[model samples]
Structures are given as C-alpha cells and as structure tokens.
Target: MFAPFAPMLRRAALVPSVHRLLPSNSRSLYQNIIKRHEDMATEHGSPSSSGEMHDALDVLSSESSPISTIPLDPDTDYAALAIPSLQSKNKANLPPLMNIPPQEDPLLHHIASRIMNHGERAKASRTVSQMLLHLHAWTRSPPLPILRQAIFKLSPAVKVIGHKHSTKMIYKPVPLSEKQGIWLATEWILDAIKGRQGGPTLAERMAREVILILKNESKTLEKKEAYHKSAMMNRGNIAIART
Candidate 1:
C-alpha cells in the first residue's frame, strides 16, 4: 500500500493541471477555441480534401487556356481569334492616278530646238528660258501671248523663191502655207537678233527684238513688209512660181 501511494504521489507531482497554470475563465475560453477547430477540421475532411484540391487546379488551367472560349469585348476588339488591321480598306478611299505626263508649249519647244547649237540642247534651253524671263520683267502680263502676237504680225502671207523662167532663173513670190509662214517669221526674228550690236548675251538680244516687235518698230516687221511689196509686184509670176 505504501509503494502504491508513493508512486501515485510522484505521478501527480510530475503532471501539472491546466487550472493551476491558467485562470478558470482562460481555461474555459481555450477549450472552446480547440472545440471549434476540431469541428471545422472534421467538416472539411468529410468532403474529400484531394477532390477539392483537384477542382481548384482545373479552374486555374481553364483561366490560362491556349484557345479562347469567351466572347470578345465589343469596343476593344472585332473578334477573339482574328488579327486587327485595315491596311487595304483605308487605301481604297485614296484618289486614283492617271499616269499622264506634263506637256510644254509646242511653239516654245520648236524655238528651243532651233536655237540649239551643236548637241548642247541643255544650254539652248537655258538661253530660251532667260529670254522669256526678260520679257516677263518688261511686261506685267504673260509673255507667251505677246510673243504670239508679234509672230502673227511679222509672218508674211507669201515667200519669194527662185524658179526657172526660161534658160535663166527669176525670183518670184509664192503663197505660203500656215506652217511655212510660222517658220519664216521665226527665222526672221532669229536672223535679226543674230546681226545685232552692243548686246552682251544672245538672250538679251532676243528679248530686245521681241519688245521692239510689240511696239511695232522691229526690223523683222520691216523685212516682212518688204517681202509683201515684192510679192505684190511679182503676182504676175505666181503661175510660173507654182511649179
């Protein structure tokens, strides 16, 4: 009986009671918290923990899917799988091109060609351009119209050419066609300008002649009148000059 009582006392001293370490109210509160934890654990374990974990993994995989399975936002995108672009549709609104070239005046081109010395066409073009610019400076209006007026005033209705009137050749005036009249007028202008004195450049000479013709005092006009006189007197030879 003594041995049993000594062993029982030793055991009771080794183990401490919860009531001694904590107040009665604290001990009751602690018990209530532990009971709530145990009930929650049992409820969660009853519904298969592994099954819930697998369901969560499936949800994550669906959110990160390679193929889209949701409708696109109407404002932000046209379609879910389609690329966004309008490169071709916007281009249709632009104006169409005809691919036509720019054209210069025919008389201007012809004059430039006639002025060309050797194969230096670029130089001749510069000279002609300078001449036109000078005309522009003197007159406030466009130069080409004034130039055409001068050409019309100076171009004779007939040209004198030598024709055989028996064994000897006699000079006779013949009626000139429209094209020939233009050519003869331009030639007279060029010839008159070429024979000038005290002009520094060919462009200046040509400009001065053009201006004089506009004022009705150019040498070209005189030559034109002289030709008309001879043509009038030689009208008798018109029949012979036709051949």
Candidate 2:
C-alpha cells in the first residue's frame, strides 16, 4: 500500500513540471522563435530546407509595416537587364523598309516620239506659219487649192532685207514686234531643215519662235508710247510753225 501511494505522488509532480515548461501561449512563442532563428541562419549563409517559409514570414512582416513602398523609376532600362543588349542594338542598325513605286510610261512619251520620228517641230512650225499666211483666203476654213501646190510654199520665208533684217514669218504673233521675229525664226528653221542642217522636227521651233516674238513685242510696246508722244509733239510744232 505505501508503494502505490509513492507512484501516484511522483506522477502528480511530473504533471506540474511539464505545465510550467510549456506556458498557455507556448505554441505561438515557439513558432516566432523558430522563424527568427531561420532568418539569422539564412543571413549567416545557411540555406533553409525550403526558402518559402522565410519568404512567407517576410511577407507577413512587410504587410504589418512596410519597409519600402516607392515605385520603381520609369527611366530604368529593362534592355540593360537582358544578358546581351547588342542583339537589340544590331536590329536597330538595319536598313529601313520601303515600298518603292514601279517604273511606268512618261507623260511626254508621245511628244518625244513625234519629235524623234517625224521631226514634227520644224514641219509643224512651217505648216502653222503657212496657214496663217493664207488666213485672208481661208476665213471660212475652206479647202485652199494652193496648200497642196508645193512644199516650199508650205515653208517659212526670210526677208531679203539682208542678214541684219532676216525676218521669218510666224503663225501666231500676239504682238507686232513678235510678229516679225517669229516670221524670221520660222524661215531660219525651215532653211535649216531644207539644207539638212536641222532635223525635220518643227513644233519645238514654232514654240520657241512664238516665245521670242512675245518677248520682242513686250520690248516694242515701250518704244511705241515714246513714238506716239514724239509724233504728237512734232505735229503740234509743225502746226505752230505754219501759223
């Protein structure tokens, strides 16, 4: 009976000792101590079995009181983070892409062809001048029996007024001064064509002659005003002298 009583007393003492060792919040306190120990071990170069445990602890701590909350810099280069930035740099150096238009027919193709084949410039200018010369005969655009008479008749004529006054006939002379110049230029071009000095083209010669005529007419207009004034003054002087 004394032996059983001693065993029971020992069991009661063991219970009190165990209870003292483990307090009411012992489980939570033990977990915290284990987490702090893991962090210290990691800082000292001791890797954890699974780093997820430390990461979870860190996230929880940060949530409670964040250490940093600022955003990353906008100017921070992500390309620099790559293993080799030369790959991107090389691509940028490549030539730019372009969609070039294809070659087509030129706008002056017809005009150029006429000039090359028929020598239309010299002939056209002469023809136009000849038609203008016969303007009085063909007011109603009648069939002039003289047009089919000869090639020379269809050509330009230079005045016999010597080299200084070699005048060719022009078809469309807007100004009187231009009228004489165009006529002379047309005759010069016609003579060149007949003498084989120039190609048969006439249209270009005609256009050039017409332009020259216009320039001359503009210059002559200035003289025309002076001549009119002088003539008036002369007539007045003559009238006064007679009186």
Candidate 3:
C-alpha cells in the first residue's frame, strides 16, 4: 500500500511543471509566426497592415486631371481646306511664265507690240517658237511617214479657199522634215496669235493659249520620258548585243 502511494505522489508533482513549460513554448511559437509575417511584408515592399496603404490606394484610384488645351495656329491656311480642289485647279492653270525666255527677235517684238504693246506677249511667242524648235531638234532622223501619221491621226479638217473662192476642207497626212515641221508649227502659232476676231487681242489670247496648250501637251513629254526610262533599263542587254 505505501509503495503504491509514493508513485502516485511523484506523478502528481510533475504535472504543474509540464503545464508551465507548455505555455512558454506556445507563446514563443506565436511570436515567431508574427515576426515572420512582418519580415515577408517588408521584403515584398507591400503595405504592412497600416492605414497609409489605404490612403495610397485611394489616391491611385482617383480620376486623373484634365489635360491643358491649346489654341490653333494663327498661320494655318483655313481657306485652303474649304476649297482644296478649286485652289489646286487654279494653281495648275497658272502659266509657267518663268520658262519663257527673253525675246530679241525684231519681227516678233514688232508684231507683239502692234498687237498688244506688251513685252510679256513677245516673250511668250519666243517661248513657243523655242519649244517647237526643240521638238524638231530632238528628231534623230528625217520625219518618218509613221510618225507623221501618228502625230496627225487626230488632225482637224482645214477650210481653204478653192477655185473661184469656194471653200474646201480635207484631212491629209503629209510627211514633213524637221525644218518643215518647225516652219509649219511657227505659221500655225502665228496664225493663232493673229486670228482672234473679237474679245481679247491676239497677243493676250496667244500668251494664254500657249501656256494652256503646253500643259495639255504634257503627254508628249511623258511619252519621251517613258522611252528614255525603257532605254536605260535595257542598256545592259543592248551592250551585250553589241559585244
């Protein structure tokens, strides 16, 4: 009986110490978990469970301020935007006056003065003559029948005084040399200058018409440019053939 009672007493004494040790271990574990959470938040650069994070989030979610407005440029061409086509057409129709060379021919000067007394008209006539001369000079050989046919394919019928002053008109493709072409062109241009029956004088009308015709006849220049471009592209083949 004494032996059994002694064992029971020792067991009862160990219970309080075990309970005290258990409370200290639990407190230390709780502190360690809290410290680990704080360190993780600091490392990640996140808000540490504070009201300052809420304030920062609110500021970020707020609406942005409006951008500052700027006035239109004073130098902007508003009228051009309204009538662009008409403006472009007018610019296209403007005469290439700068291309006209100065006139020295006494006959052209006299005729220009007699018709309009303007120096500009004389210069324009000279320009027309020079253009025709250049066209003639560009020919590598005497005019071909095919070239004449092609050029005059759309030739207009001409009315001429026939026998007993009866008028006759006909379309004929006559082969012409460079000199003849220049001569004919000069005569036609002169006739155009002097043949106005009414309205503006011949010189004034001729000056305007020459510029308009040059613009309209740009297709010829375009064709020449195309031919040169083709020749340039095939130059290597031409050289090979020559060799």
Pick by TM-score: which candidate is best? 1
Candidate 3 lDDT over 1-243, as tens digits, reads 588799889876665423334465664665566566657777787645534544433343334423459897789986767698887889989966675666654434433443433557756565535433433454433323322333333122222221332465332222345444333433444555565688865434544434434445422334334434554544443223343
lDDT (Cα, tens digit) per residue for candidate 1, span 27-95: 566656655655676688754554554454344334242434897567875553343345455576767
Quote the positional error of residue 140 for candidate 1 in Å.
0.8
Q: In candidate 3, how many Å is residue 127 off?
A: 14
Output the better candidate (1/2) by lDDT: 1
Residue runs of model 3 more than 4 Å from their true location after superposition: 1-175, 217-243
Candidate closest to the true structure, highest lDDT:
1
How far residue 22's Cα lies from its native spot in candidate 2, in Å, is 99
Arrange candidates, best lDDT first.
1, 3, 2
TM-score of each: 0.53, 0.16, 0.21
Arranged by TM-score with the best first, the candidates are 1, 3, 2
